[model samples]
Structures are given as C-alpha cells and as structure tokens.
Target: MQRFTARAVVVGDRAGTVVPDAVLDVDDGEIRWVGPAADAAPAPDAETVDLPGVLLPGLVNTHSHAPMVLFRGQAEGLPLDRWLGEVIWPREARLTGDDVEVAMTAASAEMLRNGVTTSVEMYFSPERIAAAVTATGARAVIATPLIPLPGMPPLEEQLQHSVELAAGTPTGGTVEYGLGPHAAYTLPLSILTSAAAAAREHNLLLHLHVAETATEGDELLARHGLSVPTLLAAHDVLGGRVLAAHCVHMDDADLELWQEYDVAVAHCPASNAKLASGVMRLREMLDRGIRVGLGTDGPASNDGLDLLADARLAAQLARLREADPTALTAAEAFWLATGAAADAIGRPDLGRLTRGRQADLVHVDTRDLRFEPVGDKEDLLTHLVWSGITPLVRDTWVAGRQVVRDGVCTTVDAEALRADVAERAARLAHGG
Candidate 1:
C-alpha cells in the first residue's frame, strides 16, 4: 500500500470537486481511500510520498491512433481525403509489426509524460500495440481496425480476428479489446452490421469515424438518400457500444439519433482545426444530453498527444461558434478529457480519483507562473483548462505504479526510442 499527500486533489467528478490538503491511499493498483488529509485513516504499513503540487486524475484520450506517430507532420496542408489516400495509407502499407511496436512504445511514453494514462487506440497490429502499452505501463483500449485496404485480408477475416482478440483479453484489465469499423462509407453495410453484432456478443466497444467532413457522406446520401447516421441506424449499427469520432457534420436529426441510440462521440477539436474539418457541435451535443468526450485523433492529425491543449481548443471553438463567452466552461472542457472521456469509451473504472477507481493520477506543479492567482477551487480548474499546463505535469502514475517522474518517463529509454522512430519514419517517408 502507498499513501500520497498533495496540496490539493482534483477529484475529477462531474461536480468538479477539489479537496485542499488531501491524502489518497492506494492498494493493489486501486484507490482504497481519498479525502481531506485531516480525515484520512492512519496507515502504519503504507509508504508515504508527499507531492508539493496539485493532484488530478490522469487525462484520458477518448480516441487516437498512437502508432501513427510515424506520420507526424508528414502530410501537412492536405484535406482528409488526399491526406489519407495520397500519403498516409500508402506509407502505412509498408509498416511492419516491429515498426508498430517501436512507434507505439515511443508514443505511449510521450502520452504518459503528458499526463495521459489511457487512450482508446484504433490501428493495425493489435498485438504489437498491446505490447507497447504493457512496456510503458500505460492503459489502453485497443480497437482492431477493420478497413478494406488493398492487399489486406478479407473483411470477414478481419472481423474474426477482432473477435478472437476480444474474447482472449478479459474485461477490466489494463488492456481492453474492441472492433473498429473504419467508417460507414469505407465498408459495406453488411460488414458494419456484422461487426456491431460481434462487438455486442463480446461486450466490447465498437469505435469508428463518422461525418468528419462536410462531403464525407455525400456518396452515401446520393446512393441511399440517407445521412451516415440514418443509414447506420437503419442497418441496426447504431445501438451497440458505439463510439463515433469527429462528428463535425451532424444536424438536428443526426444529433437526435445519437441521443436516442445513446452513442458517444469522440470530439477531436485540434485535429479538426488542423485538417480544416470544421468544428463539432459541442454545445448542441451537451445540451441534447449526448455523451461527448475530447480526443487527439492521431499523432499525425493532432501533431501531438497533449489532451489538455485539445481541451482548451474545444472551449475556444465552442465559444466562437455560439458567439457567447460562456458557451463552454473550463470545468466542462476539463471533464471532456477526464471523467467524460472515460464514460464515452465505457470505462467507468478509469479517469477518476475516487474510491474503487484505478489509481491513475498526475501531479501538476502549481509553482509555475501560469497557475498564479488561483483565488478558489473553480479558479484552479480555469487555470488548468486555459493555462497550457501539459509541460507542468511533473509526475504520473498508472494503476498505482509511477510511470513518469519529474516529467521523464521511467519505464522506457525515451532518447533511444526517439532515435529509433526517426530512422524508421525516414525510411517510411522515403519509401525505402
């Protein structure tokens, strides 16, 4: 058992609770107790560690392709279509399993240093991705992507592989498994239905991209006279544990469908702006009682794995879209990356620092100049959302294990990983 005393603990509940002078006790990778320091029970057999800063729940990335770190900054200034068709897919065709493992290891370390303890990953080579997550001592929900790329196995085979992976990986572990259908337009309606059915049978998450660009669903609408959401609903693909990413082009009926079906959205504000994909209806989604969480999308699209930066951008865009200063509050933004993100991905055991939850927490150095003038607990949350504190994350723990200390990852050699990725990325970029 371990006991951590902090100046303040951000409980990361829906109410934005903050306890000053708090103590948190961990046992067997789970939070045994958390409360004000004065109210904590005495623990004679626990190791004590005092943190001189604020303790908060580790940020959760609701959606991402971490191994895409290999393509970061490689296809800039291109729209989503050209970006994937011209550069990303072509280069991804050359990826080896070892390359995926190395890239994911480095990316996982980067995420951990940024105070992100868990992410929902959708990419190829699930085994390699899981290996990287284990190596870094981070948590991940791996959704094996089912895409119809050239020279790949049949769609049926891809679905079977995802099922097997999910069946083998037990529920409630550091690594969860899911099925990721690329998109509605990318696959046949039959395959989407089958995949959703399989995911439900295995009690796994069904993640996919949807309505990212204004024209992304044009072909489907022209062919079936229905929007992506409507088509999905008609085919019974919207009812499962579905997580739709980049819902920037949804309308009233589409939003209603999401609420009715209880589908969650992975709102990637940074990547949407970077690719000119437009902004999601964040205010509308929240007002309509839809579950929405912030995501970094992928290293290539977001260009980084900093979830706090995305929270800031999400607030800014919501305000700009609604033309109101209070369109989205700082507390709401922060929740999207923490508690709300966990709910969006159906992982209730993560993203909170309460009793019975996993002990995934981050230490934020309040000595930084940007955190000054915190007059109250709400003010502290405001600073966290708007003041760019990603670099101020001094330490991080995942599942009661300290993975990052003093802003450096403790589980892997970051320098060597960076060098290895550079060489591999160069080869991939040049097609050597």
Candidate 2:
C-alpha cells in the first residue's frame, strides 16, 4: 500500500469537495481512503510520499483522434468538410499501422504530461492504438472508425472486425474497444444501424459525430426529411449507449431526442471555434439535464490535446453564447474535464478521488506565478480553470501507477517519439 499526502486534494466528488492537507491511500490500483491528513492512520508497511501541490482527479478527455497528431496543423483554417475530404482523408489513406503507433505514442505522452489520464479515442488501427495506450500506461476507450470509403474494408466486414476487437480486448487492461460509425453524413442508415446493433451486442459505447456542422444537418434533412438526431432515432441508431461528439448545430428537438435516448455529448469547443463551427448550446444542454463533457477533438484540428484549455474554452464559449458570465462556473467547467467526463463515458470508477475509485490523479505545482495568491477552494478552482496551468502539472498518476513525474512522461521517451513522428508526418504531408 502507498499513501500520498498533498497540500490540497480536489475530491471531484458528487459535491465537488476540496480538502486541505489531504491524504490519499491507494492499494491494488484503487483508492482505499481519502480525507484530511490529520485524520489519516498510516499502516505499518505503507509507503508515504509527501507532495507539495494541489492534487486533482486526472483530467478525462472524452473525445480525441490520438493518431491524428501526425496530421496536426496540416489543414489549418479549412471548414470541416473540405478539411476532411480534401486534406485529411487523402493523407490518412497512406497511414500504416506503424505510423499510427508512433503518432499515438507521442499523443499519449503529451496528454499524460498535461494531466489527462483517460481519453476516448476514435480512430482506425485499433490494435496499434491499443498497443500505444498500453505502452504509455494511459487508460483509453478506443473506438474503431467504421467509415466505408474507397480502399477501406466493407461496412459489414469492419463491423464484424470491431466486434471481434471488442471481444478480444484483454480483461482488466488499460484499454477498451467500441464501434465508431464516422457520422450520419458520412455513413448510410444501414451502416449506422448495423454499428449500433453491433455496439449493443458487444455492450460497447457507440461513439460518433452528430450535428457537427450546419451543412451536415442540412444535407441529412434534405435526404431523409428529418434532422440528424431524429433520423438517427427513427433508424434505432440511438437506442444503445452513445457518445455523440461535436454537437454544435443541434436544436431543441434534437436535444429532446438526445435526452430521451440518454445520449451524452462530447463538446469540442476549441475545434469547433477553430473551424468556425457554431458554439454548442451548452447552457441549454446542462439546463435540460444532459450529460456534457469536454473534448480536445484531434490535434489536427484543435492543434493541442490539453483538456484544461478545453475546459476554459468551453466555459468561455458557453458564457459568450448565452451572454451571461454565470452561464457556466469554473467549478462546473472543471467537472466537465474530470468527474462529469468519466460519467459521460459510462465509467463511474474513474474521474474522482474517492474510496473504491480508480486511483487516477494529478499533482499540479502551485508554486508558479500563475497560481499566485491562491485563496480559498473556490479561488483555487477559478485559478485552475482561468489561469494557464498546463505546464504546472508536476506529476500524473493513472491507476495508482505514476506515468508522469516532474512534468516528464516516464512510460515513453517523448523526444524519441517526436523525432519519429516528425519524419512520418512530413512524408504523409508531402504525399510520399
């Protein structure tokens, strides 16, 4: 057993408790106890480590295309359709399994060093991505992209492969598998329904894009005589566990359908804003009791995989859209990147620092000038969300194992991975 005492521990519980001089006890990769240090009783054999900083639940990135780090900053300033069809897809066709592993390795290290331990990834080459996740000691829920394009396998074949992958996922590992049908505009009704059915059969989350752009919803409405959400519901595609990403163009009716289907939203505010996509109705979504989590999207689009930055952007965008500073509080925004994100992805054991939960946490060094004059709990939370603290993540722990220490990733050689990705990214960019 190991015991860690920190200056302050942000519980990230149901009540969003913050305890000063907190002690957290971990055994077998699970939290055994969490409370004030004055009340903690140390076991004879417990190894105690005292840290100087505030401890927080490791950030949960609800949506990402980790392998797309290879394509980061390639199609800058383009709309979503042109960006994907004209720039991304053509280059992605040349991606090999080894390229994906290299890109994901860099991405995993970057996220871990930035205090994100759990991520929901949607990409191709699931096995390689899973291998990269394991190598980096980062927990991930990987969804194999089921988009049927030229040079790609057939939809049925991919669906079957996804099922096999999900079934073959090792038990109690740091990775899980799911089915990802690209989106309504990219896939047919039959493909979407088939993916949903497969997800139900395998008991996997159906992760996909939904109502991302006005053009996507308009095209779906013109073709199907229904909105994207309604069409999905009519075809029984939303009947199972679903994580819809980039729900920026949804309406009241779409929100109603999502609520009825119990679908969670992965709000990628940074990517949306960068692509000139409209802001999501976050205030309305939360008011309607919808589950909303922060996502960094893909590095190719968002240009970074920092969930803390995304949380601040989400809150700012929500307030700007609603014209109310009180639309989303800092604590609430922080929750979107932590506990609420885990809940959105259907993992209750993650994203919180409490007993019986997975001991995935981060320690941020507050001695920096960014956190100067840190006051009470509310002030600290505000500083964390509003101030730039990404570089202050001194350490990150996932499942009771230290993946990052002193702002450096221990599970992977970051410099070597970056050097490898640079060559691959250049080749992919030049169409070599």
Candidate 2 lDDT tens digits, 1-432: 999989889877545578888899999999999999889985778988789888999899999998899999988879999999999999999999999999998999999999999999999899999999999999999988899778988888998998898988776778999989999888889999988988987789899999788888777788778988999999989966799999998879999998998899999999999999889999999889888888999999999999999999999999998899999988899999999999899898988898999999899988878877866766677888999899999999998899998989998889999899999999999989
Candidate 1 residue pairs in clash (backbone atoms < 3 Å): none
Off by over 4 Å in 1: none
Report every candidate's CA lDDT: 0.93, 0.90
Give a tens-digit lDDT track for model 1, residues 273-333: 9999998999999999898888999999999999999999999999999999999988888
Per-prediction TM-score to the true structure, in the order listed: 0.99, 0.98
| lDDT, residue 207, model 2 | 97
* Global lDDT of model 1: 0.93
Strongest candidate by lDDT: 1
